[model samples]
Target chain A: MGMHLRACFALAVALGAANSAIAETRLDTDALQLEVLAGSCANCHGTDGRMVGAVPALAGRSAEQLEARLLAFKHEENTGATIMDRIAKGYTDEELATLADYFSHLPATAELTP
Target chain B: MSQPWNRLSRRQLLKGLGGASALPLLGAMPSLAIGGQHAGHVVVVGGGFGGATAAKYLKRANPAIKVTLVEPAEVFYTCPFSNLFLGGLRDMRSIAHNYDELRQRYGVDVIHALAEDIDADAHKVRLSTGDTLRYDRLVLSPGVDMRWDALDGYDEAAAEKAPHAWKAGHQTTLLKQQLEAMEDGGTFIIVAPDNPYRCPPGPYERAGMVAHYFKEHKPNSKVLILDAKDNFSKQGLFTAGWQRLYGDRIEWVGLSNDGRVTRVDADNLEVETEFGTRHRADVLNVIPPQKAGWIADRAGVTDSSGWVPVKPDTFESQQVSDIYVVGDATVAAPMPKSGFCANAQAKVVAAAIASSLEQQPAPTAYWANTCYSLVGPNYGISVAGVYRVTDGAIAEVPGAGGVSPADAPDTVRALEAEYAVGWYNAICQDTWGTQV
Candidate 1:
């Protein structure tokens, strides 16, 4: 999955947008999409956007600031980023906004420990 | 496999769920709070990534909904970082996780037993311990079992000789021992399976990791990949990484190149290719074709393909009701059967079940998969995608989730290697409530 991934990705976005319009009615498309999307970030950002170690905590962060950073990463402008930029590009602006708002509301707890 | 659950007598059925003996196992679950939101009980089979995540997320989604996780193991060893162990980057201790957090903190009843049977209609699951647990819903992350009889001369017996090590447990240790005992300059042959196997990038990453070991310990040793597939995920990145790190120490033989292994010999540690060519190995690792776990078949969720076909959004079994199948046992194409996908799918299934029990709207599902493979201990590559239920099946969101740039700097590869470990820790911690 080298250029093959990028090549297929460039073509699929159009079909995805077109299908979203039709799939939205049957699949609860617009409602609570952020729920699962935000949870997925827990793999790196920690559960509910809380961090356990060196990675920054997403919990209780400012929504506006978080969204701005996500947008920058998505746009490949986050100079200090690692895989976040790659992961961020997979999200839309609206999805990024929803994630930021969702995490911002989570109580900023201490670093997670098992 | 025998369908023992189907022959449950009328008396056993009555005793399994109705008898007073089952109440003790119920503990806090069967409270008669009828019409209350999230008052149902969930029985999750398997304690690996999917089942463990489902159990934890079920509790998180609704604390009132009782969750009983049925797993045979007390300590769960993860497949995600097992490769690092094989490469000598990490040890087995760092790959083990337990259910303490899920049980103590999340209030999940962790049952250490094999889930032997699933009477879907009766909403009952029979355990190997001769106990039957009743549930309002079931989540199965049972994972895959090797198709023991798929290849000729390759069965349970052959595995002991040339272990698959597909499931990260004792088999992992066995393979490591064989590798350690292998003579310098000996060949380590990895038999890669066909398409649609668990972790598409796994076999290649394994080749890279093993080559790393050979480079340091046995520079004269060769790592040969006899693949059933002609093309593979991240081929460019892996080939480049191999050349840069191990020179000509690693080699790949694609299916078209007569690399598809059709049989194996445990006594001699050898395998035969499709072209009737027999290749001897100092140590053989066969990642045989796989099917859904045995319990999935017993539950009647699997089709002729021996894999469960799940509804795209909720991962509900297309063939059965009240049971959701996740992880490697599922036919989730475009989204590879990696631990990341299972964890993501479990969240959606948990939300769907919680919403149904509480009479809420179905939550929209979005799945993201990022699979990282270590080329060398410090050299890593990845493929990622964002998916949703579109066109009535799970399809990747376009323009999102791509592989590492083919020409990325070595610094980027090294950094990705670090993030790969970070991703593993965060996900394992998030799922099992502990970072190993």
Candidate 2:
């Protein structure tokens, strides 16, 4: 999965390789895992990570972008981060990757409950 | 459209249970949900953060699950942001929420009534309207009810003079009016209860907000907090913020300092502390000790400590089968009884129950919470934590989350304040689909 994500990220914002990578990851992860995992981000980021203002909405962001940013925050690579750094470090690299992939597919304004 | 409720048919009308089952929205149980169990009825009592969220998320997790929310209020005035209202930063309407979205958007049946009793043996709940609901699962987010007479000389009648304002809504408005009517230089006393109460950081945050109000309007008025605990949540940050922002306008008294208020003379605006020290106040806000809301007691879920003990992974009540409890009512220590924690716990229970109905293994269970307190309008401080079940209880992940650094600049504080509003908006949206 790391190699897959790295290769997908190397494609950089292009949906092709990243889509395939996440598509494979989705097969083994049950809906319960994905939905419950993503639900956590809803408190601050809005349901499906689609927070409308001040906080950037996570929906539709490329998986690479989301994963890369989450890693940077977790590792303290982003000095300007306030809360995300602390929150990101709580999850393993794999869990963060799952979250990034989870929010990457939703629309920017997905319904709170669908 | 306005709908009428009839006792002849009772499916659901309570918010307490939302903390137990609000996730999954899979269209239909994939024929694997325990062999013909097609997402049975979930009755939720209490429509606050935990219950409303559970109801909404249960539907989200499985659209086939019949979810009914029971809460007595048409509009739930949030206790979370009501402090800001106390500080004059917000209005009552901004903190008000309703069941409109939970009903129309999520297809949940929202019933406005007080849940009276729980027949655990029969899996039924008796409501104030003389109606009853039967459910395959029950979620109780019933919040807290004051332990009347726990504090000497403080009871329902006394609350009229020294308003607890702890439950929000009417008491919140009442306290604000008292603040407004007080003399500019008068002392406002806040009596904070002992530990294991709802919102560990709440009393301190209340002091901060009331001080803010006095700083702007009264200028010379002062706030004095009398606490039962020697230390409080975000103590250092709160103390530092108070000193830097309000500067002597607010003072806190700890247990060692004889800060425990033992008896109250509400009519005379007086209280006696431990060591027989009496103090007078122009405005008295007494937040008394509490227990799980009565329904939890009626449901036979609460322990002698007045809080419901729950399973680490699923928040299911230890005392009752098929009944789950979340929010202030549950013994979820390390996870403070904040709205954010309740909302987080609500989602996990929703997933756990949804998966159970689907005959699947439990879902990935981890929770994160961030609590932002504004010492002043542009002076915000926060504490965040990520938690997981460890040794059969919720424990904070080490090295992952903590209080904001002591050396943050005003610019960062301002940003955090904005983020506070964003958090409120997003979380409110997540729970009841209400925003301001």
Candidate 3:
């Protein structure tokens, strides 16, 4: 049983190393985390932040612009909103920065088809 | 001219790669440790918001992970916008979506087969197609099933006669047909279930929508609600909307006033209340009490409440190893069983699963839920919250989210209605990998 456990542990270490190498060429851990975090916004902002209709789209805006808007909402400076003021208060400034950077880097489009 | 490669979305690139044909390569991967195995098999049951989002995010987090989704239906009808369909504000096709994008763009193997049985100990699932599948991890989002025995004389046959329309497909159409067939002064009755049911504000929304229909078409028609609970989600907003738009056309009876339905006589078109009072109606919609889908019970993951308990952070089953449950089937208290909540939970679980495959500790998980209910053609109300794991259970984050303010201006209400439409489109794109 000990021998089997040791073998499994060794294989796990090797696989982890290989994954780290592969992940370097792809999205790093921080970038991936930001991507997942931004998914919560998709329910209103559209997939990849390309919204239609009255809601403002989040993609392709400057990082500073996104950050400023988020901070305003967070600090309750942006009043007369329905759900955004409450939703923005949920995150810290650090998360807001990460989200701004992530969405800013995404391609901005006027509309997206299925 | 050719499109720039950088302009291609992640889903576009995936579909261009012919990923669906690569299923054999995925199935050939070696099955080793549960969370530590690279390119591990993750079988997701159901193709609704929860399971579809989980499958897509799991593949996005780790492209090598194999996700096979087991769902019997070829087309999915969302419960979110279904009330609008009943209200004649939308069509049935507007709410129906196919699984082609989930299969092609996300590399999810969409199998139109019922998951007949789950062998938790062996980590295998038997399908109605006589095939058995092995998985390193299983994500069950089978939603909910009606508790047929909860109400006397309410069964499958009864549902056919007096549709529940809870599952959001043919039953929705059936109920709409019944309403259309009613006389001008006919009575339309809705029997609401107890708490912890899927879409807490759904019954009230249906009532409002039905009232809207009656007000337009049958001016003398009346809509009656027989609720099993004294209070409900967004009660103030719903009642206010009913009073403003529906007037005396709509009425509600709470359980405290003997409104709880004891039995339903579908053939006679009558419902009996707790006080043995019988109310006959031209149209009866009996939404039976619910429990987690039968698959959860068969897998032995559910508690006595007919829902599966899970570790709040990872959504892993508390009773069974190597299995995760989300959506309506989960005991994720403080977080309603809503589509938005399920989508958020799926992302958290996806990240946790990805981290586990690398043998890393699960990361800090946060989730959110927003439910939008339309009261009239141009009016809407919403409830939202942010949640995190605290003291070993899910709890709402303080001062982070709230419902729509009561007695808002018509402009605000109208804007909310537009946002509701936007939310439906956006959520469909997020979950099904395309617009419905």
Candidate 4:
């Protein structure tokens, strides 16, 4: 009975490690794929991508806004941004280029409803 | 109205008029005047747990303000502990309350009229009887309203057939009839709605009690819960109780498990799922999603979300100052919309309205709530919390509240269930001025 309990504990630890590894692999990405992913994103964010509210549609964001957010996620400076980082984490350099191109192409809407 | 009777506190006078003989309090002229100053008048729109307690305590705190209560119902039949009645352990009459004691003992002006409108600027309320009442302050505690349009092929008309029965009255009686007449090898389907609805664990408890009735009477019937949400309020404890007591007779499906009920064809007594699956049952109980009572919307108090927004401490509307919304009508964040919470809020509103009437500072308010959901006979689970106003919203005091201990002994669990019934009776008695 003691041996059975020990084996079960060991199996649980192994499964935990495997799950972490799967999460790590998903975080590695190319920039070009990231850019391609931004097309569907424009549905929520207006052109020029300044978004609104907690679920803001990002349209007309400044170049600085994109760079600051990306760096914040990469360095873990903004810890509560797990969802955003998860979306951006897999991109390669070329994918990032494509993403920037897609968002930058939009026209910015000025008005917002309360 | 000739030489108004001498003023006395409700507790003292009511205790004096014991037994059922003093039930009709209409003739007793109890005035709220103190020190010969003209007293303010407080008008409460509904006589549920919230409005009743507020009226009861407001009179107790100050015999000065003339309190007038307007409720459409002659007697209130509470939704709480109706499950025990369903289980056949308690009688329906035990859940009914009379407002006569409230009128006679507390000297409350109990008017049985539907509130038609509120002219906030004039500080007056219009009733269905074409009569107008001027109020120093107004408290509205009309309980929940069902969203008949939320589901396709369902509305007030169709609900009469399948019966949501969410609110107790004729619908409750109809649902009870369906269960009683159901066959031994029948299927009972309960379609539960999404969040921000009344009685989170209510549908589950109802399922258990009905199952209990079936276990003894029908024996072969089963209950299937088609829930819109994946995780329920007390899932683990409910599952444990279902497994232990009811065996495999009960089943629950969450949203991810294709549990979302999309439509109901009341003609065929059939329910359709989002995946286009149809389920026909011997008894169909659709506890539809709800909103603030319809009057709130008609009065332009509720936002698009179908709930009224209020200043947390005062329970006064964010839109209008003179009007206060309590009970299930207001958006009380960090507090579940339960009868206990409604009672707590009514107390705060009562104090605020009373204080405002005297042109004095409204006292800082505090509230306490304990919600108990019974899973079976002598088996219960609960969540308790104490609340205070912070940052203009009601927030639960951290470290002051918690859910029932995860592993309570059976005896303790039974005690909690008993206490739950007792609490329900106490609250109903306190609010309506008569015990159910």
Candidate 5:
């Protein structure tokens, strides 16, 4: 099973590179490594992954919604959000999945406004 | 319309450079090659306020760009609130920041290494460990380097005895130690540096904080500021606060009154004035003249004035086009060299780099700053401004911001203190990840 898993991982890498041709030209895997996100979203978003107004609650965002928003910026669909778009364009699909998983599992943070 | 954002006047650029070397306004274009991580790598030198801010923002703005921040030290002791430590309001630990949060929170590649050399032509940074890191865009925000010879008989060696505590950290602790070991009635004199220095109101605030200590613990002790310049930021308010809080207990001498320190005798604890007056103080906090960090000079970014010249709107180095110099290291005309200025400049640079990289329309760049100085415990004052890049230089937008109301009502000053701390936290969030 271990040997088979290793072979599958190797094949995944090979296939991932082969599939790069069909991927969007702007979709760079390295720049968008969501695993590198430390604590930047905590200010506007609650530490527990809840978000303030307009920031959108990251607590239960669907993986598709997350990927779509990120891809929207990478493809230049959203030009209004400069910083977010630029940051989103740097993530790889695998890392994006990790972020989507992490945020989706966290409980929603409560809003501070009275 | 295709011209780079805005061209600064030659006079303004010269004034910005302050007579260093003549550098091209805009030189070579960056390769625009695909960086290893999709976005180009941003190599940041220094881990203090400015460098840390830039590194954090670069990652936050676009995580695709691999950000490698290099600093020699393990921890950063901020100069902003160090004065409070000297006055016994806070401890050294309270003011220190470790990059652990920055690394864990921002996913920044933190290299605990001193930037010994730079191969700018090759776009490679050679770390002290003999490791080489390449960058597509380098952000040099190494803060200020002290010009020791500016004061006769005072060099790095003399600094051991008469500590500057200007850069904070160990020096701050050393100065605090000296203050602690001082005789109750000992004279504490702070020699203020010339213009183009960090935290213009810092020395005055230090004087106020130290005087606060003297008033409470050692009523006979006094503090004096021997300044090089005639005017200072928030001068009227600082002086008024000093008069009300520690009148006659603190003496502030400026250039107009011959406060310029000519020389110092470290062994004798004596400082000679321009007017031939000699002062012998038990404790001397000599904040010397400063220049852009040595890394800027080594990288050939600095001109004659020992500061890097850059296009204000883009924050790109004039000498080396692909590289941008921000923070206190850059000669940001009409902008005081402060942490707030550095944070604002980091945002502008981040946006411009993103725009340039994506071939998108550049956004109109603006900057904001709010410098707060604590006059005493819970007694604080502030000056806030919103800046706009005009004619290639950052100029304060008229009537956009103002200083904390003069001799501010107690309620206002107290609120300013609260806002000041909040502003620090908010700006820190803008610069670093909000983990802490």
Candidate 6:
């Protein structure tokens, strides 16, 4: 029984090691974080930044333009009445740049339309 | 100025944690991707914020995956901005959304039918229409159900007399009517439920809205709040706002001060508290304690707390395989049961499902929630948070999000109120694909 338990433990460790190796090779952490940061904008900006109302859509803009706008909000220079100014302040400059790049690459039009 | 992107590398940060590799572990599993096809059928129950967003994203994530959304209601009334309607700042049609866009625009098979039973083992769902449908993966966003027995003498029958108005539609209209029918100098009582209820700031916001209505229509009327908890979400901001806007019109009694309602007499419109103090009011709004919806309980996914336990990364039920639970039905701690939270969780689960179906490494999951509440027509406040899955649990990232600043300028408050309306339109558009 002890030998059987040891064999099971060994198999689990082996599987864990194999998974770690695969993840290190396959997962792109940079792309994942950028997606996470950009996805947060969807709460008020519409999904993938295709906003329909007064709130401006963030998709399909130049990365430089998006980065400049976010930086302005973050620095409280172009402060808005809403929470965007405060929300922008929460992210680092690097994170803002990543979000800009990510949203800039998404299709400007709604992707879900038939 | 753009800062360099590699300030804090997620890979280097997660390197020490060997468990970070669980993403690929999920990839190695046998694809539930069935029938010799690259795509699989994903059935979503409950077409609220969670289910609707999931269905849309599932199709977007993998055009091959067939998505079916089962919802009993044709038009959905959101609880987020319904308080504004009650306050007379907006109309009912503004908060209502239909499934036309989600159906025609997203190619989702939107079925307006009741989901009766879930056969987890067979991956089949039995609908009220006497038809059974199969799914490779099932998503349940059943929201919440009021515990009728939680408050003595307060049940569905009594709720008809004094509406809870927690669920949006008829109950909301009923509460609005009651407020309108109230006499000039009447007393309005709001009974808030215990911890872990839907939308923590909801009852307080309702109080604000009612007070606003009274101030405009019946200046002599007063609003009383009997709370089950001493401290509430955004308490400082709410109390401060109440003092400024409604003055003495709104009064709050906490649990510590014998404020918890023990029983109710709907006929007399009287509520008896823990100290046996019976207070009679012209109108009473009782929000009872809640649990996972009836379907979740029937599916045997709920634990003792009456909420489904799920893996933080994927929102897959810990009790049942291939079955994911989202929204207020799941035990997503540190994350309040709010519409925004539900939408955020749906995106994470959709991405995970897509990666699994497509035989790719699952992306690391992160979620964010922001809830905006209007104290009055021109007064607004909000709370926001960013969360990540760590050590098999959801944890709020430090210094990521916070409540609206206390004692802000009137201009800031007014701007938040306008943004609140904009947020409602944006979220509705995102969820239902409707142009609000």
**Could you list the iRMS of every candidate?**
11.8, 10.1, 6.8, 30.4, 16.6, 8.7
Better of 5 and 6 by lDDT: 6
Ranking by TM-score: 3, 2, 1, 6, 5, 4
Q: What is the TM-score of chain A alone in each candidate?
A: 0.66, 0.67, 0.69, 0.46, 0.53, 0.64
Worst 10 residues of 5 chain B by lDDT: B1-10
- What ordering of candidates by DockQ runs from best to worst? 2, 3, 1, 6, 5, 4
**Model 1: how far is A66 from its true place, Å?**
1.3
* lDDT score at residue B277, model 1, on the 0-100 scale: 85
TM-score of chain B, candidates 1 onward in order: 0.91, 0.91, 0.92, 0.91, 0.89, 0.91
Candidate 2's TM-score:
0.88
Tens digits of lDDT, candidate 2, B1-436:
0111211011121111222223332322232223433458899999999999999888776655778899999999999889999999999999988889888867789999999999999999999999999999999999999988788899999998899999989999999999999989999999999998988888988999999998888999999999888999889989999999899998899999999998999989999998999999999999989999989989999888888999989998898989989898999888889999999999999888877765666665788889998888888889999998888778998989998888889888888888888888889888987652
**Cα miss at B5, model 2 (Å)?**
24
lDDT of 4: 0.68
DockQ metric, candidate 2: 0.34
Candidate 3 achieves a global lDDT of 0.81
All models, RMSD in angstroms = 10.4, 7.5, 7.4, 22.9, 14.6, 9.7
Model 1 bad stretches (over 4 Å): A1-34, A76-80, B1-38
Residue B10 Cα positional deviation in candidate 6, in Å, after optimal superposition: 33
TM-score of each: 0.87, 0.88, 0.89, 0.73, 0.74, 0.85
lDDT of 4 by residue, B45-130 (tens): 88887888788767655555678899998878878777777777677788888798788877788999999888888888899999
lDDT of 2 by residue, A1-114 (tens): 334443333343353333333222111125455666667688988777877877778988998999899999998664688789888888889878867876786666545421
Backbone clash tally (model 5): 11
| C-alpha lDDT (0 to 100) for residue B279 of candidate 2 | 91
Which residues of candidate 4, in runs, are more than 4 Å off? Answer: A1-114, B1-37
Q: How far off is residue B144 in model 3, in Å?
A: 0.2
Candidate 4, residue B136: Cα displacement in angstroms equals: 1.7
C-alpha lDDT of residue B287 in model 5: 90
Candidate 5 docking quality: incorrect, acceptable, medium or high: incorrect
On residues B1-436, what C-alpha lDDT tens digit does candidate 1 reach at each position?
A: 0111221122233333444332333332233233233358899999988999988777665555778999999988988878778888888989999999888777789999999999999999999999999989899998999998888889998899899989998999999999999999999999999977888998889899899999889989999999998999999999999999999999999999999999899899889999998899999999999999999999999999999999887899999998999999999998899999999999899888877775665577878888989999788788888887888989988777888889888898998897787788788887897644
